[model samples]
Target: MDTSGSLSITHLIFNASPLVQIVMLFLLGLSIASWTIIFSKSNSYKAARAKADEFEDKFWSGIDLNNLYQECIKKGQDLIGLEVIYSSGFKEFVRLINSGPADQEVVMDGTYRQMKVSQSREMENLESHLATLATIGSISPYIGLFGTVWGIMHAFIALAAVKNATLSMVAPPIAEALIATAMGLFAAIPAVMFYNRFVSKVEALENRYINFMDEFATILNRRLVRVRSEMNMKNNDVPQTNTQQPSSSYSQKSYNHPLGEEQHSPYSRARANTHSSPYQTPGVEGDRYRNTSRSPLQGQ
Candidate 1:
C-alpha cells in the first residue's frame, strides 16, 4: 500500500506476513550461499584445470622422473593436483627401492597405493561444499512453494472478513504469494546447473589422475627393467672362468714326484745302489776259480 496504490517488490516483501517474510529471508540466504559457492568453485575449478594442464605438459615433456620429483619437492606445500599424486608415488618408490631388496611387485603396489591415497585427498578437496549446494538446489523451490501457499491462504482468509473482493484487494496478496515461487526457482536453477557442471569437472579430473597413475606406473616399471638389463649386461661383460694348469704341466708332475727336476722326490723308486759286496758264498760262485776256499789252498 503506497500513496498511489502502486505495489512494488519492496512493498510486497515488507507487507508480507511474518511467515512469508521468513521464507523469503530463508530463500535469500540460500540464494546467497549458492552464489558464493558458485563463485568460489568457479575459481577453484579454473585453478585446478590450469594446474592439471601445466602438470601434464611438464610430465610429458620428456623430463627425467627424478628431476620432476625433485622439482615437486621444492614446490613443497604449494604442490597441487597431479603434482601431489606424482610426488607421493615417487617418494614411496624411492623409499622402497632404497630400503633394500624387496619384491618388485610389492614395491610397485605400494607406490600405486600411495598415489591413490593422494588422489583421494585431492578429490576430497574438490568435492567439498558440493553436497550443500545440491541440498539448497533441491529444497529451495519447495520451501518457496510452501511460503506462497501460506500467503495465498492468508490472503483468502482476509478476503472472507471483507464481504467485497476487488482486483486491488485480490491481486496484491496473490502476487506476493507468487513471488515466493519465483524466488524459489531463482535460487534453485543456478544451483542445480552449477552443481552438475562441477560434478562433471570433478569426474574428469578423477579420470585424468587415474590414467596418469597407470601411465606413470608403467614408466617406472620400464625403468626398473632397463636398469636390471644394464646390470645383466655389465655382469656378462666380466670374465668368470676359473684358472687351470696346462696339460704339459700335469705331464711334468707326478704323485709326490716332479720328473726332470733336480730335487729328490718322495716317490723315487728307481734309485741305484752306491755300495757292492765283494764276499760271495761258495755255491753262489757257480764253479768259478775264485770259488776255491782258503782251506783248499792250505791242503795243497
Candidate 2:
C-alpha cells in the first residue's frame, strides 16, 4: 500500500464541499466550546463540593453558633454553597434576636426564608452554562447528520453528470461527509456524559445544602426556645414589692373608717389592719374576725 496518497484530517476537511466544510467548522467550534465548558464546570463542581465538605466538618464539630457565624463572615465571599446558606441564616437569626421583642417563631421563619433564597441563588450559580452543554450534546449529532445527507446528495448529483461513475469516485465524498457525523458524535458524547454527571453532582450538593439548612434551623430553634424560656423565668422571678406597698397604703388611708368611730369593735380594728396588709386576700381575714367577734357576743 502506497501511503503517499493517504488523506489526512486537514486534507479531508479542505477537500470537502463548501457546505460540508461549513458543517465541519460549525461542529468543530461546538466541540471546542463544549470542552471549555466541561473543564470549567468540572473545576467549579469540584471546588463547590470541597468547600461544602469543609464547611460541614466545621459546622458539625460542636463549635458555638456565634463563632461559626463570625468565621463565615470573615471568609466573606469565599464562602460557597452551604456556607453561604448558613451565614445568611445565622445572620438573619442574630439580627432578629438582637432587634428586641424576640419572637422565636418569627425569627426562625425569617432565617429559613433567607437561607432558602441563598440556596436557590447558589444552585443557579452552580448550574450555570449547563443548558449550553445540553444543547451541544443533543444538536451536534443532528448537525453532523445534516452535513452527511447534504454531501451524499451532492455526490449523487455529481455522479449523475458523469458518463462512467465508479466506487472510487463515490466513496471519498461520502466518507468525507461522514466526518461531520463523527465530529458531531465526538462532541456530543462527552457533553452528554459530563452533563449527566454534573447534574447528579449538583443535585447531591443541593441535597447536602438543604440538609445543612434544616439542621442549622433546628439548632437555631432550640437556642431560641432556650433563650425565650430563660427570659420568661427571669420575668417571673422579678419582685413587685415596690408597686404593692404604695397601693396598700393608699387603700388603708381611703378605707380607715368604713363603719365610723361609734360602731367600732375589736373586729373592726382587725378588719381595718387586714385591709392594709399588701399580701393578704382582700376581705377574707376581715370577715373571719367579724364572725368570731359576733360569736362571742351571741354566746354572752
Candidate 3:
C-alpha cells in the first residue's frame, strides 16, 4: 500500500460518482457565492459605520445646515443618515415658509412631519438587501440537505445496479454527501451571524438619528418660542384702537355672529380663538394677540 499526500484534487473529482460530483459542484458554487456576499457585506457595513460616525460628529458639532446639506448632497449614499435628516427637515421648512404665512407653529409642525418621514425612509434604505442575507442564512442548510439527500439516493441506486456491494464503495459516496452538508453549514453560519450583527448596527444607527432629530427639533422649538414671545410683547405694546370699548364691542360682535361665522378676536375676548389669520387679521396687526394664535412670529 502506498500513501501519497500528492494526490491531485482532480483525481478525487473524477473518481466521485456523477451524482456526488454534481452535489460537490453545487456546494462549491454555493460556498463561493456565500463568501462573496460575506466579503461584500463586511466592507459595506464598515463603510456605513464610518460614514455614520463622521456624519453624526459633524451634525452635533453645530455646522450650518445649508453647509451640512451641501456636504450631505456631495456624499450622497455615504452619508445616508445625515442626508435623510436634512432632506426631510429642510424641505419641509422651505415648503412651509414658502407656502404658509411665516408662522412659527406651522413651520415647526411641518418640519416635524418631514423629519419623521425622512428618518423612516433612511432606516429603510440602510436596511435594504439585509432580507436577502437573512433568506440565504435561513435556507442554505436546507438546500444543501436536499443536494445531499439526492446524491445519497443516487449513490444507493448505482450500487444496487452494480451487483457488488462493498463497504468501500458505500463509504466514498457517503463521504461526498456529507461534504455537501458541511458546505451548507459553512455557507449558513457566517450569513446568520452577519445578518444579526448588521441588524443590530442598523438599529443603533437608527436610534442615533432619531435622538438627533428630537434634539434638533427641540432646538428649533426653543428658537421659535423665544421669537414668538418677542413678537407677542411687541404686539402687546401696540395701541389698541377701541381701548375701553374693545371688550364690550368685540363681545357684541361675537354674540351677533354664528358659532362658525366671523367670531370675535381672541385679543379682546380672551377666548384663545383659532381663526385669526396670523398675518392678515386686523386686531393681531400690532395689537395684543393671544399666545395661542397659530402664526409665525414676525421675525421667524
> What C-alpha lDDT values do all the predictions have?
0.73, 0.72, 0.60
Write the residue-wise lDDT of candidate 2 on 1-300 in tens digits.
127865577777788899999999999999999999999998898888678656665655555565677788898778888888987887776566545454567878999999999999999999999999999999999999999999999989999999999887888788889899999999999999999988888877777677677766776676445444543454466588755544322223321222233223322333434323211222443344323322211121
Runs of candidate 3 exceeding 4 Å displacement: 1-10, 14-20, 70-79, 102-105, 161-164, 238-300
Candidate 3 least-lDDT 10 residues: 291-300
Give the C-alpha miss distance for residue 162 in model 3, angstroms: 5.2
lDDT of 3 at 276: 31
- Candidate of highest lDDT: 1
lDDT score, candidate 2, position 43:
89
Tens digits of per-residue lDDT, candidate 3, 1-300, equal 016534344554566667666766766776677667667766765665566556555554545554666666676565466567865686566455444235677778889888988888777876877787787788778877876797688789889898879886777666666666776788788778878877776766666667667656665566445434544554476577746553433333321211233345332233233243222212332122222221222111
Question: Candidate 1 lDDT, tens digit per residue, 132-238?
Answer: 99999999999999999999999999999997688999999989998999999999999999999888888877777787788778767765554445444543564
C-alpha lDDT of residue 203 in model 3: 68
Q: Candidate 2: lDDT of 247?
A: 34
Output the TM-score of candidate 2. Answer: 0.78
